[model samples]
Target: MKSYDTIIIGAGMSGLAAGIRLAMFDKKVLILEKHTIAGGLNSFYARKGRKLDVGLHAMTNFAKKGERGKPLTKLLKQLRIPYSELALNEQHRSKVVFPNKELSFTNDLNIFTDEIISKFPHEKDGFMALLEDVRNFNEVSLENPYESAKERVSKFIDDECLREMIFCPLLIYGSAWEDDMDFSQFVIMFKSIFMEGFARPEGGVRRVITLLMKKYKELGGEIKFRSGVSEILTEDTKAKGVKLETGEVLLADKVLSSIGYPETVASIKEDLEVKPRVGKLSFTETILCYDKKPAELGIKDTIVFYNENDAYHYRKPKTLFDEKSAVVCLPNNFEIDDYSDGMIRLTFMANFDLWENLSEEEYKNEKNKVLEASKDIVRKLYPSIDMEPNFVDIFTPKTIKKFTSHHGGTVYGSIDKSRDGKTPVNGLYLIGTDQGFLGIVGAMLSGISMANLHCLMPAGAES
Candidate 1:
């Protein structure tokens, strides 16, 4: 049995961040991952010389300055990861196409406002008031407790199209809760994106994960892949160690779980005094096409959103693919030149309950259905590109569950953002998106916060 000061379960972003931070502080650390790679959802795969990112498309929160201050860049600096930014075309930062009309949201806030005004000239007052509401929500989010994005939208904007264009997509993109999530929480999410410009790492998100893993190893942190923890050994209501799938018992002073709360407790198989409420966990499903070049799709460092009138259709249980679709550009210069020849990645949120009980044959059939749906969306958005893709990669909620061990393959660890970021048991910590936020920056911040709290506690003080 191997022993360490800390054992981090799941080597996703949160786990890696925690391992890096703890190791840097001279605490012996070990990160155990069920998959061969370190990145959880952010990892990529190669098929027939084509590389496809599992879930990551374009990332936000990398802006140099924001209302809440510099996020991605600041976090990178603190982690000692060297990074450079890429420019997203202001003309087509995001294009929303509905049945009646299409609108483009630019990177510049003023341009975005002007474009909206031009489209809905008569509703100029409504548009300006909506922007003000967004600004006010950002300013007072940390203090207020509004309970639904829809409520906030109803209060600020009366135009259905404007509300659909903004809040509808925002709800679909951020959480699994169909447009009815807490308003304050939704506002904070929106503020992070508008106030902070979104950018992709020069080499890809995997580069960021790889650098953090390297730094963790440099600090004497150990990692064991394909070693899933089957049980958490406890005594007197405190975690003491873990038993791996291979029956190897490794003891640690503390265990930090980057996986979701339910999965962590399920693995431990113990009754805790406090149990977190389990809401719907959102899964990001994508079908990556390597058939066309970036320019062929009219994509130039920009993302495309195809608006669906029925965003609520996702609430009903469905397969890995849904009606709502978004396409992201992946340029050849960003990653490996060999496989990056001509790649465009398409992603959408999937309902976890839809694929929770599929057989092998059923799963493949459902996957094909998803691929077909993605093709339909692609044809509508990029008319120039061919419908058939040279290569396609499909990731369902089941695939996510197998790799990350998150309940229902939830990308985020928890849904309740109001609770203090803590588990019920002592010496146990929960980080990552499951708690309600998403993105690489948010995951890293959670890990950093947990690690900081742990470091402040004296050695052997809790265990």
Candidate 2:
């Protein structure tokens, strides 16, 4: 049995990033992925010769080449990836659409600030104050304790409508907690979304995965696709190695799991004294490929956070899905429209249990209904575009659970995050969603930070 320096569980963004970091320093690292592909939630699939991105609507925290102190810049710098490789296309604009109000924003913070001032003039001062608070707060601090984002924002913004509108995009995009998010997460989202804003890699999520995989492979990192880990071997309250489902045991001095915290804990044979609460949020997305692009139909927004009601309910739906609110993404609306066909993706919060309990036929019927509802939303958002989609595909929480192995089909993992990536078991760490970071950029950052802090620093010091 060959002993390795580190074994990373899951080939998701965090895992891939951790593997790359470890491998960069010549550490013998192996990444085990249950799926055939990488990217985890932010992955892609091909249907009828067309590639479709899964979780990536837009990559937040867009930065210009060599932009210092930015998340994107930091991530690329840490991973030794050049900014040019991303081929980022900035979003034309995105909106928060409420019942009687609409706020549009672009990559520029001025645009969002102006929109807020114009729409909610009274709350302008409060919004600015909130922005300052968000800017000043070190959201990435590992020692920071959890606080309700809603409560913290309430201190700045008094108008409930404005508050709901501001949080609509942020909450649905990244929050693991229902209704509200942790304050640190809120700040992270706020900076990434409103401050740095949105952009997409030229080839969607595939571009990102390809870049990561290329870098990781160049560093001599080893990864095994469809190599699902059955259990994490522990001895004397420390990680010894991992046992593959096929009964092969690989020994490692350290194990870093990009899988969610609870899932990692469950995989361990030892009954560790910890119960990381699984998050309640999940989603169902409908992808429609139309004959004409959104721009051709006079819809130029890159993404629209659509809410029919004044209050945004960001929680698990009692029904199959909550139709009142949705995230409508127009991939073609970016600066460079690389898609051959116009694509519109609509995401609605859904209940995993409701979808999970359905029989095969019932599941199919429910998915059809969801597809119809998504079309209805498109119609309502843009009445001028009245044409049947050339192709339509819908994915539910069940699909997320099947592909990602995330509990509750959750896009974001457990609400209880391990900020420092430390687990109860020695030599084991958590990265990705449950590591308290948000979005793709955050996930990669989590992996890099954890790998540096827990793995590399000690090795370098010892050497």
Candidate 3:
């Protein structure tokens, strides 16, 4: 018999943000989470006395306090959270390594531009033109049509190598499509990673989650952990409410789902006209803990996008995992080293179906291989790192599926994004990854934007 003004599904970045926004406006909001914990994908776990973060390397879209028009500033302002609470530390620098070429960049855009100009001297004008294009494009517009990023970027840059290098980090960090991403997504990632750059909260992602939870509760928002939604109850193609896995029904005037696009469709029994395909991209990450920090080992880079060949293969692997390419993150290389011990996280593209078909013992053996490969990559990148890690943990696509419940362990969600957040069913909306916004900042923005457009707008107002 109970009803809420709005019900937000999943306690991920987007869901929590939506709940907080709705509650701030005095709307009775309820957040239903399937797991006991919050921070659905970007969460943390304690294992053998060590706290490890999941799905966080470096938070992109870093901005200084009170920086005008920046994503980080806008996010905090919208959530009414203070920038000081985040305690963010900027990255020292990151690199993109492809065969004989290596380009280094920091929080400064000039450094990246200079690197490009220094290496690809002939393409400086083209690069600047591309940057202008990215700046002028209204990437956030809901009505914009999808265009191939590679094709568009090629018009600006002549050399294929420079283009591949440019896209290495952007594609791996945000794209749902293989090899390339939408032009709009490309611009978003470009500005966030290259222009604004990376930073990390002092306590990793947990601190951010804690702040949102505290803020939401203070605003009188309700969140039920372990309350899994079994079905989105609908009538006449309109959302009625939701049926929990426990067979309990809760009514809501509107529903916002952050789980994913395809997953959302699967929850409803009605044969809707739209059927979004699940994204094929997945990853396996190897976490290594060392007694000595990376700086002590003479490593200065915060993160490195590594590729053995000229081409960057940012897609699902045919094998268990792609060994030639990886995203190696040195957490200790940040401006401030908060961890007691050094840590390195290596992420490799993986095939979900291959990992899902393995036996228990086979899975264990495959994980060991991934760990060895990770160590090999470290040795290759840092030849001085000869000692074995004190602790090592590897997670495959199966782990991603088990924890986040994203089909195929898809990190970026469905390829068919609902840019406007509107579904075929009235009173239903999509946010987070499937909504086309990416990273921690993008996810929160998606939630806030959707909530404002759908629930907070005045009667008869345009969305």
Candidate 4:
């Protein structure tokens, strides 16, 4: 049997961050992961000769090296990574295209504001008022107890199209709730994506993951991949240790789980009746590799949020693909290098329950249908490009499940904020998106904060 001060479950971005933090305090920590590699949602896989990025399209909360107190800056500081060494490349512009109205966003908040004023002259005051609320938003409780994003946005903007355009990205990005997403989450996503904008590292998320792993190992943190926890051993309402699938028991003073909270509860030996909040929204991601670059092919824009109609109800579709909206990302547009080829990625929501009942052949058939439909949408969005993709890869919700064990294969963990990384059982804590964080930066922050509150706060003795 192995023992440590704290045992962290899952070696995703959050788990690795928390492990590094704990080990920084000289505490012995062991991170157990089911997969052979780390980076759960923000991971990548190889197909043929291409290195296709799995989940992350872009890193939000972008900040420059000298920028102080920003989330990315703080993350680098906490992890001891030099900001300059990060070498982030800022995005020029990204567009949200509705049927009737379109908005472009940039790294500078003022530019976005200026565009709002230029596009909607009459609603400029209302948009500015909404920005003020977003800037001043400080609800003490982490739980999202206020009205939904749609409800809150409408309070400021009378124009329905503007309101939908403003909140559409937020809903698709952070919201797992169908009808509406909480206002607190809205403010966070708004501040992160719009206020801070997005920037990609020199090599993308793979580099980020490599840096995290290196820092973790340097701090004497141990990570065991391909080792999944079968049960969370407990005694008297407190976590004792974990039993691996290989039947090895690794004891610890405390268990901090980066896995989904509900997944954690279900992992325990005790039959706790905790109702897990399966995320309402999941997605099917299709990657297409082309022999021609976007610049060469007459496509300049990097990311396009396309909504076929004026309605920006960013809810999960009842079918495989939401005909109303889809996000198309051109990877080659952002990179400044002389890379000869390009990659196009299409992402839209999916319903796992619908795919759950399909058989093997039927599953392939359904995914192919979604894939073909996504390509049609992409071609329509860029009618000028005559270049055909040389390679294509499609990942459905089932792929997400196989990798992350998210019950619904949800990209957004859950909408419930009250969980706040705590559980009914003592000596057990939850971190990561299921606790309300939505993106890579937020998830890392969640890990750091949870470590401070749970493990590194001291108060430990193990048997």
Q: In order, how many clashes per candidate?
A: 7, 0, 0, 0
Model 2 C-alpha lDDT per residue in residues 30-144, reported as the tens digit of each score: 9999999998888999999999898789999999998999989999999999899999999999999999999999999999999999999999899989988998999988888
Model 3 weakest lDDT span, ten residues long = 454-463
Error of 2 at 5 (Å): 0.2
Q: What local distance difference test score does each model get?
A: 0.65, 0.92, 0.95, 0.81
Models 1 onward score TM values of: 0.85, 0.98, 0.99, 0.95
lDDT of 1 by residue, 130-206 (tens): 66776665432234554667766677677777666665445555664544667755665565554453455545666
lDDT of 4 by residue, 195-293 (tens): 998777777778889888999999899999999999999987789999999999999988988778667878887767676766778888888777777
Stretch of 10 with least lDDT, candidate 4? 454-463
What is the model-wide C-alpha lDDT for candidate 2? 0.92
Clashes of 1: 7
Expressed as tens digits, the lDDT of each residue in 392-412 for candidate 3 is 999999999998899999999
State the TM-score for model 2. 0.98
Against the true structure, whose lDDT is highest? 3
Off by over 4 Å in 2: 459-463
